[model samples]
Target: MTAKDLESLLTIYKEVVEKIDLGIHVIDSNERTVIYNKKMREIEDMDIDDVLDKNVMDVFHFGPAEESTLLQVLNSGETIPNVKQTYSNNKGQEITTINHTFPIRENGVVIGAVEIAKDITKLEKMIQENVYKKGDTRYTFDQILGNSAALNEAIETSKRATRTTSSVLIVGEIGTGKELFAHSIHNGSSRADNAFLSQNCAALPDTLMETLLFGTAEQAGTEGRPGLFEQANGGTLLLDEIDSLSPALQTKLLKVIQEKKVQREGGTEDLFVDVRILATISEDPIDAIAAGKLRKDLYYRLSVVSIFIPPLRERKEDIDLLTSSFIEKYNHLFGMKVAFIDEEVKSYFQEYNWPGNIRELEHVIEGAMNLMGHEDTISFDHLPIQFRHKSSSSGGSNDLEKIEGLLYQPDKAILPLDDYIHEAETYYITKALQHHDFNVTKTAKALGMSRQNLQYRIRKYNIGKNTHS
Candidate 1:
């Protein structure tokens, strides 16, 4: 061919290569980049001058995965098709690409390879659309309402913690909404779609706890069951009241947390698991250890990222928000049109110590709504007995005297008031004692008093005549 004709042909070839959207590169056998098109420069957000003649490895880091693919293609002198890679451009933006590399031949001898890479970021994003959208419910950050600094900090910490893979331990008093925080973490996590399995350690018996946590083998009378751990694989597992777990079960749980594996009952094989463990303890694990109820090693493992939920009394500012929310919920559930709580009732709720926390508050509002008979508003009359007593006790020195003055009054007046006061005290104390099944420790907790104080009262009032020592 004539020189002019050859030059024109070469120009035409260059134009066609430049017009192609896929990035093209020719690398010599030594893995040195030789020729590259403008598309390659554009995709990498780099100038041709910065990349040409440079060793491919020197120009870009292929990560462990892409490096392996490159090595295979180079050693085999064959095409490596559809090798996916994720890399950042010069502008520091992540991009996904599907790369194809094939050996180049010169006179039947492999000289180098031609690499073509097609941008697949958009395609990859479309594939992940469902995963990205998972667990995005109607709830948002605003749904967690509390002005108290401690609660605000906990919420912020939870939000940040959601971005990590660390296990979380939530410790709080009973009814303080530990489960609520656990659900919030699950909903905000990447594994939210899998499953959120919760098990109350105290509620399950030792004989069944293992079967409930790890699957039980199939038997003649019963179908095989996948326990909470198995069901929560690739998701999250919430162990509520972790401190209440039996010592033997605690050992088993520690093993699972350490190994990320669980052995099903009546099965020899161990199953791999990928569940994120979240545990809660109403009682302090340290105290549990002192009481010989919880294993120290298990406590340490579960408490890797610990969160202590302040009691309602500690965060009194949140009482209004929590009460309002409960009022709305119970109003709907009880078929009540209650739109607002009386200001006095709100004050009483805010001022009174919520020993039972959010769960107790919910029950109180439910009870009030039921008593209102679907009234449009909740007033002081609808308040629970304890709450009403709290309001009355705060009225003035006169009301204060009714409680403290009982200790030192004339025998004549005391004779009549004593019976009345003692009757009221006995009623509540008996109810609390029964509610906690005569466990003095728990009854003291429910009554917001020390065990010693409760013991004294029980003795003074002559309660539990049949059981008392």
Candidate 2:
């Protein structure tokens, strides 16, 4: 081609390259830049005049410590395809890109490399702030109901839990309102207005979970998107089912807690965050540790201020209050006018230990509300047959509870000791029988009494099945 024709072709190519959205860069055998297009300037957040004819690595390495893709290609004489690069440019702006680098060859002799990159920093920022948005928490301390001492103690612990940004470990069974406590703690903290994000450690696999909690450069490109910890910066992150987190994730979490910084899955920079982590596990800490699911050091770090929510069965005295609260909630939810609960229903509730805790109580009330026809009152017929027929506790526990209540009766002082003893024994035996679903063999075994002896007592006391249910 003629010199003028070649010059015209080169100018046209440069214009076309600069017009394209992707970044185009080239270097000669001496590692001096041959091309730095307009899009490359925008991507690096730098000026065109400063970058042209410069070493790509020197210009690209702002604060990033990892080796640059162009540097690797230049040294290895190999073509590197789809290399994810994370770096800050001369403008001090973080940049992420997928680079395709190829060695320029003359008759099979390696000369230089050409790098083509796509800026994904804008896309990542959009995803960080918009798509995977960190939202405001809708839960607070007022949502946790129950005035019983045991429940109150837990609430008070939550109150204290909210006073600091230290990591917390909430231990409770399923449906025990562990998430509520986490929310309350976050909302109560100094960072309440910032952001709140939760991740169920058990809900995701190790690879996905790592990217979600700590973020990854593979998908987000060089300057990757923020993970949950970064997203909840200056706020709180709730890690539910923490015991279910794989060993690898558990180790990363422990490192985050200890170092107060996180390294993304592919990025080299350690991003510091002011996020408070609140981890929850349904199983006991000891059990989780013994089972090798929860690391002991991680447990110690998370439980700097541990809070245990008592199960419904252990805090039976709170049932009446919780039931009333749930009744009101369901009333509004189901658009019902349940102004009162039948005393019979109350008796059934007090007797039926709730294994699912507050959540179960709410569900029961919801089911009852949905089942109610037009009555202004809730009755035994409204309750699920499961709640009515089955005792949440074992026969021995139900009988023991009955005996305790009997001992505390207001008129116990007036009754003769012998009569009181007989009355308590009869009441406990009946409860035992009921708890065992009227199975004489199971009830007798639970009470450590002979089946014949229990039957005799039942017949003598006239403990009919109808009398209990």
Per-prediction TM-score, please?
A: 0.54, 0.59
- lDDT (Cα, tens digit) per residue for candidate 2, span 144-193: 77767877888898898777788899999998889888888877878777
**lDDT tens string, model 1, 1-469?**
9999999999998998888878988878787777789888877778887777877666675555446345456668878765666766445667766677788878977788887887656544433442122244334456676799988788888888789878999888998777778878888878767677666677646655676678666543234556667777788888777877788888988998899988887667788988899989888768888998878888788777888888988998887788788877776676667888876567657656677887778878887777887567787677676665654444323333444335466653454775767766876677557645688875675456799999998889888864331
What residue runs in model 1 are displaced by over 4 Å at the alpha carbon? 1-141, 218-224, 373-376, 390-469
Model 2: ten consecutive residues of lowest lDDT: 126-135
The lDDT of each candidate is 0.73, 0.77
Give stretches of model 2 more than 4 Å off. 1-135, 218-223, 392-469
Q: Which ten residues in a row have the lowest lDDT in candidate 1?
A: 126-135
Measured by lDDT, the strongest candidate is 2
